[model samples]
Target: MVELRRSLSLVSTFLILFCTSTTAQPPAPRRSRTRAYIEVSCQITEYPDLCIRSLTAYIHGANATILSPRKLVHYALLASQHRAQHTRAFLLQVSKPLKAKKDQEYQAVKDCLEQIDMSVDQLSMSIKELRQLGREEATPSPSRDDVVWHISNMETWVGSALTDATTCLDEFPGGVRMSRMKATVKAKVLNVAQVTGNALSLFHHFVVRYRVPGSPKKP
Candidate 1:
């Protein structure tokens, strides 16, 4: 009778400890506040899903816990830059095997390689200009005009990247034999263009909502 009572007590003690340990652990982390904010901000873009996905991946890779508007814009541009670079590499690799074919499709791939390379450069420049915006703003005698010019330059570069992607597709002759290669090129280029377009939209939103350090105030 005593052993049975002791066994019951041990079981009760184990249950109590288990419950206490579980309850003492911190609650599961809630959805990231920054992710929620990004979702809302991305709604302004035509490709909201792409925007969110790209930014979320950036956030994860960067482990960016705190972010400002400029930082957010930088991240978006960086993501766009990465996408363009990957597409460029893909084109380069695929073109290697077709170099000897000397066909129309080979010619198309050659042209696309040039345009995508250009697009990669434009995006690289955009990121450079974005960083320049911050440096210009941080100067002791910051110039509103300079900041405006840099912002304008970023917009133009991003737009040009989009344009370059389209030009790449236009180079591929219609109804070609290399439909598989052409389709892959089309998809990759379009993905870069769409992501850049979303970044462009974010640039506008950043301009409207968060004034740069050197931006002029309304009279």
Candidate 2:
């Protein structure tokens, strides 16, 4: 009888250990590559020029790519603004315990608000510079080569900003929060991509429309 009881106890111990191990394993990370791609495509089609402008702005402003410093900044600003606008909504959704000690959370939210303000200030400054450069390039009397050089410089600055933004996103730690932020940034970057493509298309169209009919196509 003693031996039998000991055996039963050992079996129970093993079962408990097995159950704990199995339950403790984290759930497999959710893969949403397809959904992400679709979201990116949708965002790209919405406003190509703004997308391009944002991309350029990010490059010139942050030395990053479309998604890195650029998109990250864009979404950060957006999320910050969103937080500010829905202060009451967020407070309502918190658990009772957290709500009871809301001051700490409010401080964090306030910091986020400050970050958004800084991003807006930086973006505004970048846009002003870009507009000035654009106007200079647009002057009717400038030589064709000079205009091209200015445009190329503008493009380079935009591309750099995009690179920076994407890099920042890549450095974020893996988790649900990062994934969600990534999705938001990707969506915004796609918009910038669409805008870039559209601007190029429109520029080409303008060239075609104004070309002297009898002039031979430039080689």
Candidate 3:
């Protein structure tokens, strides 16, 4: 009887341990509560599909929790910055083959390159300002003036970046308008400009929805 009771006790202990282990849960991700974060956030953007595509990769995996309204704006800024960098890199490649041509088209391409270089710099500043906004969001009680200042700077810089990209395409010489290289460069620049404009829209959305008085704070 003693041996049987001991055996029963050990089995009960094992069952308890098994149940405890099986029922245990890891912490739920912010994504779980925000299943529609991507959908709702992208819906208001200028390019919904591009916004969705740009942010979907970051919304999964270890970075999944980065989905507050402010973080979404940051993500959009990052996407714009990446697109600017890509467009700049492609322009560099296109410039290489034309460097020694010394034709009107070559000079025009050089002019576009300079404009895109400035666009990249402008986007870089926008990205920096957005990052500063993130830091401000973390403060115990961020100042309204600081938020306005950072966001205002981001708006101006990102708008300038978009204008610069447009100017790059406009500056493409009429001689090269039919060239495949020019078409490719122009398309890429347009992509960067579109995404930057969308990101700026999102920044405005965030400010209106979260930064204003009586706006809802993150849960």
Candidate 4:
């Protein structure tokens, strides 16, 4: 009887351990929650599908609980910066084989390369500002004005990047509209512009929703 009672007690203990482990939320639930959060946040953009596609990978492993609104904006900007870098590289490839013709069409391609380069630089500055914003928020005592200031600067930089991307297509004369080269460049630049727009929109959304840690209303 003593041995039987000990065996029964061990079985009860094992059952308790199994139940405790099952009570905690598993990784699959965390991953789905994270994905859902990203999808909802991207709905604010004009190109929601594109926004989700670009951003989901950035926070793929992170749980939804840890992703603050500011972090969402940061990840969006990172996606924009990456898109701009890739577009710039593509522009360089497009420029190499073309002869330096004096025509407007050829010159537009040349101008686009410079424009994308500028966009890349602008995005780099914006990405740095995002990093600064993160550090500022993580402080023991963060200032409201400082956070607003950093966000404002980032907005301006991203806006400039969007303009730069669109201007690549603008330099072409009306007659050369959507020529083969221009069309090729347009496809790439348009991608950059859309992603930059997504980043800019995310900033606005985040700022509107952001509130001080203890404040009842948004700052």
* Clash totals for all candidate models: 0, 24, 0, 0
TM-score leaderboard ranking:
1, 3, 4, 2
Q: What is the TM-score of each predicted model, taking all chains together?
A: 0.80, 0.29, 0.73, 0.73
Candidate 2 residues 27-57, lDDT tens each?
A: 9976344323323532433454353444344
TM-score of 2: 0.29
Candidate 1 local lDDT, 1-219, one digit each (tens):
999999999999999999999999999888798898788888999999998899988668878853566767788888888888998899888888788665556778888889888888998999899888878877877677887888789888888888988898787655765577788888888888888888888888777733645445321
lDDT of the structure predicted as candidate 4: 0.77
lDDT: worst 10-residue window of model 1? 210-219
> After superposition, which runs of candidate 3 have C-alpha atoms over 4 Å from their true positions?
1-35, 60-66, 172-177, 209-219
In model 2, the runs with Cα more than 4 Å from the true position are 1-140, 173-219
Model 4 TM-score, all chains together: 0.73
Off by over 4 Å in 1: 1-27, 172-178, 209-219
Query: For residue 8, what is the lDDT in candidate 1?
Result: 100
Tens digit per residue, CA lDDT, model 3, 81-102: 7887887787777777787665
Q: Which scores higher on lDDT, 2 or 3? A: 3
Error of 3 at 182 (Å): 0.8
lDDT of 1 at 202: 82
